[model samples]
Every structure is written in structure tokens, then in C-alpha cells.
Target: MQIILCESAEQVGRRAADIIEARVRQGPAVLGLATGGSPASTYAELIRRHREEGLRFGDVTAFTLDEYAGLPADHPQSYHSTIRREFVDHVDLDLAKLHTPRGDAEDLVAEAARYDLAIVGAGGIDVQLLGIGANGHIGFNEPTSSLRSRTRVKTLAVATRTANARFFEGDDEEVPKLCLTQGLGTIGESRQAVLVALGSAKAAAVQAMVEGPVSAFCPGSVLQLHPRATIVLDPGAASQLTMLEYYRDAQALNDGLQ
Candidate 1:
């Protein structure tokens, strides 16, 4: 695991986009994308590069991490629309190649299975982007979620729904109680995991995920076991990490070598 402490949220976004652009430049690549405010900046920067720097995503294949179980693909709040509005619509990425879990499928169980197969069939994700939930969940794999779990439908924890209420006109009750998400095991299979967090609100979860014990209670901690995982955070989010100075020193050394 590599921890990169940045001075601000925008820097964190730039750093993350740097990692992603490098992979896309390596040739055709499969990318696992996440939605929400945490990744909005990164997506924005990528869009800027595409428009101002000639960055191309024409050969990239993308997959969304999860979706609200009952939301239609056309719903404004659906991840399908969210991702497209936030990132896909701005880039040259082909809509046909962007795979998102069919949250509205009549048979979600089968849909989850098919989503997993689609990922594997695409040669696996070259780099998976992630966001650490304030409650330590990742892709809706809430507390106590099995470390070896696969893609599946999961009941939304109250806290998770509450946190997401902002997207639903500030009504927690309006948020879906169920969602289909990629499990920790499925996420860990990606070649590279890039998790980005910002603000003091995420400090504790960030600390636990990077420095605490590897337990299912904190799903994001599974990244600790990943062979290649990069954690990008702003100073506020890294505030609770005990080895803050060490991470900064290490990042400085890495920058020098590069």
C-alpha cells in the first residue's frame, strides 16, 4: 500500500488522474469507476485533459462499482446517469463499452452474477478507483461484509442511506434501502486500486483503512492486502493517520526518483 498525502483536495484529484491517465496511455485498459462527491474532482480533471491536452479514452473500457437497486437507468439519481453526466459524457469513451450493473433488472441476483462475469471477461480492471465511505464501507459492502464476498445485492445500512440523503433532496427516507455492489473480494481482484478521500470528515475512516487491523468491519481495509493499492488523500483526510510524516517523506522520495 502506498499512501500519498496531498496539500489539498484538488491536488489529490490531480494525483489520482495522473495514475489513471498513465494506465490509459499504456494502451487499451479496463477501468473500474466509482461515483459520488469524492471522485467528482478527479473526473473533472480528466475531462479537462481530454479537452485541453488531447487525452483520449476511446480505447478504454469502464465499469461502474454499484447502483441503487430500484432506480431506472434514466433516473437522474441513478449511477448510470450520474457517471455519464459526471465523466463519460465528457470523454470519448464509448457508451457501448461502459458497463454498469443493471440495478433495475427483474432478477438482480442473476444481474449481479452477470456483472461479475462481464468484468472478468473484459480481462479484469487495470485500475479500480474507489472512495472510502464515512462509515468505512466500499461499494456498499457495509460493516461485517465478508472479505471474500462477490458481487451481490446488499441491504443499505441506515448510516449509509443517511449519508447519501444529500443526493435525494436531503431526505434519507428517499434513498434506496437496497443496492447492488461489487464486493471486497471482487474489488481486490483488480490489478491496481486507487482510493481517494478528502476533508476532515473522512479522517477516522481513512486512518482505520490504512493503519488499523484488516477486518471485515472496515471493508476499505481490504486494500491493505492488495498487491498494488495507492491511497490518495488531502491533509484533512490524512489527519488521523499516525504515520503521517512517514507517508509524506516516502512520497517525497518517490517523487524524486520519478
Candidate 2:
């Protein structure tokens, strides 16, 4: 695990984008994308590069991390629509190649199984982008989720639902109680994983993910076991990490080497 402390949230986004852009430039590649505010800036940065720097994603195949159960693919609040609006529509990515879990499938169980198979068929993800939930959940894998879990339906916690209430006109009741999410085991299979966080609101969760013990209670801590996981954060988010100076020193050394 590598902790990269950036001076600001925009830098955190750019750093995350750097990892993704590098993967896309490496011939044909697969990407696992995240939704929500943490990755919004990263998507914006990628869009800027596409327009201004000639960064192309024509050969990239993308997969989104999760979706709200019962929401149609075209629903504005659904991850399917959100991802397209936020990133896909701005890039040259092939719409046919981008995959998202069918949250509204009549047979949701089968949908989850099919989604997992689809990922395997695409050669798995080359790089997976993630956002640590304020409660330390990744995707919709709430605390106590099995570390070896696969793609499946999950019940969203109260906190998770409340946090997402903004997308549903600030009504927690409007937020779906269930969701479909790629599990830790599935995410761990990626060649690399990049997680970005910002602001003081994320400080405790960031600290727990980076410096705390590996446990199901804090699902994001599973990244510590990943062979190629990178945690990008702004100062506010990294404030609670005990090895703050060490991480900064190590990142400086790594930058010099690069």
C-alpha cells in the first residue's frame, strides 16, 4: 500500500487521474470506475485531458463499481447515467464496451452473476478506482461484508443511505435500501487499485483505512492487503494518519525515483 499525500483535493484528483490515464495509454485496457463526490474531480480532470491534451480512451473498456437497486439504467440518479454524464460522454470511449451492473434486472441475483462473468470475460480490470465511504465502506460493501465476497446484492447501511440522500433530493427514504456492488474479492483481482479521498470529513475513515488493523469492520482496510493499492489524499484527509511524515518522506523519495 502506498499513501500519497497531496496539498489539495484537486491534486488528489489529478494523481488518481494520472494512474488511470497511464493505464489507458498502455494499449487496450480495462478500468473499474467509482461514483460519488470523491471521484467527481478525477472524472473532471480526465475530461479536461481528453479535450485539451489529446488523451484518448478509444481502446479502453470501462466498468462502474455499483448501482442503486430498482433504478432504471436511464434514471438520472443511477450510476449508469451518472457515469455517462460525468465521464463517458466526454471521452471517446465506446459505449458498447462500457459495462454497468443491471440494477433494475427482474432477476437481480442472476444479474449479479452475469456481471461477474462479464468482468472475467473482459480480462478483468487493469485499474480499479475507488472512494472510501465516510463509514469506510467500498462500493456498497458495508461493514461486516465478507472479504472474499463476490458481485451481489447488498443492504445499504443507514449512514450510507443518509450520505447518498443528496442524490435523491435530500430524502433518505428516496434512496434505495439495496444496491448491487462489486465485492472486495472481485475488486482485489484488479491489477491495480487507486483510492482517492479529500476533506476533513474523511480524516477518520482515511486513518482507519491506512493505519488501522485489517478487519471487516472497516472494509476499506482490505486495500492494505492489495499488492498494488494506492491511497491518494489531501492534507485534511491524511491528518489522522499516524505515519504522516513517513508517508510524505516516502512519497518524495518515490517522486524523485520516478
All models, RMSD in angstroms: 0.6, 0.7
**For residues 96-186, what per-residue lDDT tens digits would candidate 1 score against the true structure?**
9999998899999999999999999999999999999988998899989999989999999999999999999999999999999998999
Predicted candidate 2 versus true structure: per-residue lDDT over 1-258, tens digit per residue: 998999988898899999998888879999999998999889999999999999999999999999999999999999999999989999999999889999899998889989998999999999999999888999889999999889999999999999999988999999999999999999999999999998889889988999899989999999989999999998888888899889989999999999
As a whole number from 0 to 100, the lDDT of residue 195 in candidate 2 is 96
TM-scores for all predictions: 0.99, 0.99
In candidate 1, residue 32 scores what lDDT?
97
Q: Give each model's whole-structure lDDT.
A: 0.94, 0.93
* Clash statistics: count for each candidate: 0, 0
Off by over 4 Å in 2: none
lDDT of 2 at 75: 97
